[model samples]
Target: MTQKQDGDPKSLSAEEAKAEFLALQERLRAADIAYHQEDAPVISDAEYDADKRRYAALVAAFPELEKDATQLNSVGAPAASGFGKVSHAVPMLSLGNAFEDEDVADFARSIRKYLGLSVQDPLAFTAEPKIDGLSLSLRYEDGVLVQAATRGDGSVGENVTENARTIADIPEQIAGAPRILEVRGEVYMSHDAFAALNQRQQERGGKVFANPRNAAAGSLRQLDAEITRSRPLQFFAYSWGELSEPLADAQIEAINRLRSLGFSTNPLTRLCSSLEEMIDHYRSIEAQRATLGYDIDGVVYKVNDLSLQGRLGFRSTTPRWAIAHKFPAELAWTRLEAIDIQVGRTGALSPVARLAPVTVGGVVVSNATLHNEDYIAGRDSKGAEIRGGKDIRVGDWVQIYRAGDVIPKVADVDLSKRPESAEPYSFPHVCPECQSPAIREEGDAVRRCSGGLICPAQAIEKLKHFVSRGAFDIEGLGNKQVEQFYADEWIREPGDIFTLRERFGSGLQQLKNREGWGEKSAANLFDAIDEKRTVPFAKFIFALGIRHVGEVAGKDLALHYGEWSALTSALDAARAAALAHRAADEAEDAERIAAEAEGRRARISETRAAAIKACGVPNEAQAAWDDLVGTDGVGPILALSLSDALANPEERAAIDRLADHLNIVPPDAPAAESPVSGKTVVFTGTLEQMTRAEAKARAEALGAKVSGSVSKKTDILVAGPGAGSKATKAAELGIKVLDEAGWLELIG
Candidate 1:
């Protein structure tokens, strides 16, 4: 076994550490399930300790790896079946990890940074022993225990109220508490109780639990409440989920309040004023780990102030307010078999590494991600060799480790055991699914297939994207139905989705007679499809599935254009400008070239001015290219891609056909009864009545165009306290100008 130096993750290369970290995460997660859910022993306690330590050292060494790595502080596996599921109001978030003393200091520093506090300022933290057991959430309504649940996947949990009522430590009712309260804590069995239960199991020739944590989890998950009552399960209130009213201002006070409410709160939790004190508390807890009646894996540190915690908020899956410093992991070795390329919805080819099955941590991992070709070639994105240029090849012995819930990766390859037939794998340069030419553009590590509309893979992917939750979101037209339609020739394009009832509703082979379709179901599907005919401008744009144009970009384009016709006209003008510019560049004669260039420039300038006038703003395309690219969040690359797609004759025809059948609504007009409604209004300087954003929103809501700058087409300019250049421009353009009060009166 290779022992990692304390606090030094740099001992291994970046690739090595990442692979080991991912493997350790998976291993630890499986170990957690076996120890906490299944009541089984896959590895010895010492081995589990070693795996956890190594995993922590790797994380501390390379902090950047933490972003993609599995969460280090998650307690148990997902809740087992046999109970109904309950959706939690506030998500049950997990904590981050702190392995060493420096890590603890960094945690404190991060909290200070998030809260904008200085080093000298006092920031208290509450330190508590991280209990090793199943997590339970008890809900109380009007001071009565109404519902109890186990944290399933953080968002939902299994309803275990009957099982929870059996635990003596749990309170059936609490006086002087909020009307709605959810107390979250750990449920565990003491060491002595576990020993006694295991002794009884052995005498009866039944399955004996390997540990108390496992015993408690197995006992509490029993389908029969009477069986759970027979077990010696205990509950310790340490935190909470949802509450109708505030418990207290600080963390320590809340725990004390839980204890006062007849809940068995952990007695060892302490408040520390400094990092030194917190570390001292951690050491004390570790020293008393064996003597503690219940099992504890590590110490947890949370920001003492509830307001500071609120400000800190959460990461994707964990709260930034707290961290659990864990112990080390177990390790194993496996052989690399082959590497495979899998194309995603956007046509980006991702590499997957196939490996010989090996158990590390506790689960069998047969595959890991090579990330990209660069990773397989033993180089970083910048072409720098990693791990001394140790490229992974087929038939090489590789070390693997698991931590929490992270996917396993190839840590280090054993060159000594490399097979004689091992060869360097070549990444594919073509789309394996469609036989299309895949290109890797500059500044991009990913290679994407360029056969848009023609490639079946790209077509199907786009169709799936169109019906996604954020896109068209049409009910009864899920991915499977879309796939079946596409395969059966019933639908080849998005436009076909709208024309389904027209083409096949009265035919002999009607949709009602299909395998999954009945008369009511077919009618429902048609009704659902028809109901989406008049979609919002943003939703329509997003449903197009143009590359790089996500939900945000779609809304941006919609707001910028205001109407579908305007957007199409702008794109057409842009296409014309591109052609003119190209023609000017290709002219060989100096005089002719100069003439063409001048004409092109004039055409572009004219188009821009026309766009500005129509839109009642100063945003004019220097060229058609500038108009699309200038929109917020729509960069040159995305703009070019959109224009190119629109420029294609076949694509344009299909879009036109789709547009013909649908009524694409323009941007909403402001409400009536206001004089400035439907007019282009510009706001300048500071508004005393409201913020600038509020003023603009109010104008737009009243069916007025809120422009940023004054132009000839601008109907009115609302000048405020500090009005300057814009006001003068409005006057020069002979546009009407109003003070803040005057504008408000006019609107009223």
Candidate 2:
């Protein structure tokens, strides 16, 4: 009869466990749908697994509380509606996870207890890399591949036979396979392939995939076979589903048989006779993961002996003979020294958790993303209460972890270690950099400064971005130089960069006489700036640092508008649209205010009239706004942000001044003679010989319009490794798909 602590599932009472159990079920179900159906993961794998583990722990602690439809018994969500339904011969069960070495030891001990084996008895286990990919089952009849299905909801799956047939690694005809065999494997994209596919996706104005696993899943489940053919998908056979005959006596032998039958198997698979050896092998695999060309989140250890495995048979959803040893989350506990708000180029006031120096996965981490105000207020992106509704405060002990080894995030807070003197952190209503009012729009997690380019922080950041490697990339004009110039008011904006030689070259306080600047170095800097004065349309668009406009988006905008004036006009129109929307909203508010008070009616009416006047847009302007919104990859959210930035008179004037200083070249139309020329082209996945920027530049030079996404409008899709949703969509649209070599040949 232990009483439950607020957030501790371990200390939960029976009643508390029941409530938490129901909540977890709903949360997990939503997560499953988001991951399996939409291919958009709302939470990290570590967070998802933690939730599942907590539910299991609660159920284990109170066995009677377990329900029939518990999340633990499920594999994945049901098959998406479009695909043909497939009934799995054997349920594709998920493995129980082991997050620690002790968990691995417990798994071995549990097996020993179930089998009633002596401690001294040798328990051989086969350890293999746990590929982060889509689980696929290939059914063969008389050594010929007959059907293939995805592991949807364990028992029922989506039939992807035609799509599976296109995968080169999946044999159409096995030479020595059993009469009826169901080879279970993972359909995955290599790291290089995934990169190339993303690159192609960006180039074509297609949806960029989140990770290799998502890419593989999205690719393999394509409705069109041709799309699957274009994707760089590979499979690794690890287990069997239903077999007419026993392939081998042991797991290692069975894997060898699969390899012999022309199936790709993980080369890191090893047999371990002891727990120590098994754990050691897992460590070895973990160490090689970065260099493995594919993504592996963890390692799987299964009993080698088929007899022993059968003896320790099935649990509700997992096999007792096997356990997935997950790589330990790169987490560290540290005191939150302070919470600082950093204004981005887009004017997003991002909260950063300044932590006491702590090591996470061997890297010294002193800062972690608070994400937004909601996160700081102990709420999720959806505004749902998190961490038992405990807001993070300065001087609190918090757990930080790196998600995918890229972004450091605050995982959990140790409430017991929170300082008594610490008060709840109050996020500022104004931008710290420029004292501008920071407003959080409805449904937006981030609170952004509305100052636009007028904010010193935003302006300086835009200047930094303008001079960045992917933009102007002027030599001798690095971040330090940009910062120094901005601080000294020598270069307050991007336009100033182009006029620096004229303004500062012969001045009393010349750049040559400044600290760290010799006459030759200053001359070289000026020369570099001069060289970049005549910038490409794409580069110029990107240098503007518009909100939500990344390199790909900039390229898309450039391709769509063609000329600087056209692009600027479209942006202005979009800005006018936004202004009109805001005016209408204000007028409505004024009407309400006038109704509330008679004295304020005249003032309110005057304001409303002004707002309505601002809202007025001509047919041409409306059409420009329509074009801006309709552009591929430039959705409403991005369009709104871009419009707002450009609508600000100060920002628009700054951009116009910058444009005047630079000779902005219009985008070249695709070459008429080239096969891919004039085609709306998309590049997905990784390129071997050149970077994505170089490929995009080359494609643009050849007169191809590089888009960020795929649509019916896309004429050609240049697919590389890890081509996911876009490639599939292209096939559905009957768009032409080409590999890197094909693209090169066509361009030549």
Name the 10 consecutive residues with the lowest summed lDDT in model 1.
582-591
Q: Estimate the overall C-alpha local distance difference test score of candidate 2.
A: 0.77
Mind giving the per-residue lDDT tens digits that candidate 2 earns over 410-482? 7788999988899988999999988889987543446779887669888787787787655677878877898
- In model 1, state the lDDT of residue 620: 34
Q: Which ten residues in a row have the lowest lDDT in candidate 2?
A: 1-10
For residue 22, what is the lDDT in candidate 1?
49
TM-score of 1: 0.57
Q: Write the per-residue lDDT of candidate 1 for residues 1-748, one digit (tens) a residue.
A: 3222223567554444654564455446545655543445444444455566677667788865543334355444444545687889987776666767898999998778656678999999999999878788999999999999987657767888999999999989899999999999999988889889989999999888756776787888888999899999999999998999989999999999999999998878999999999999999888887698777767899999998777566654677799997644446798888877766556777677787887653345676656567667777544556656788898888876544223455556788999888888788889988888888753345677877777777788778767754566677888799888888888778899889888875542578788998888888788888988888888788788775555556767898899888888898777755444333322312333354567743343454345434443322333655767657556544565577778889878888887887888776653565677778999998888755655776676566878787888799999998999999998888999999999989888
lDDT of 2 at 193: 95
Q: If scored against the real structure, what TM-score would every candidate get?
A: 0.57, 0.49
Model 2 ranges off by over 4 Å: 1-328, 403-407, 506-509, 572-618, 672-748
RMSD of every candidate to native, in Å, equals 12.5, 19.8
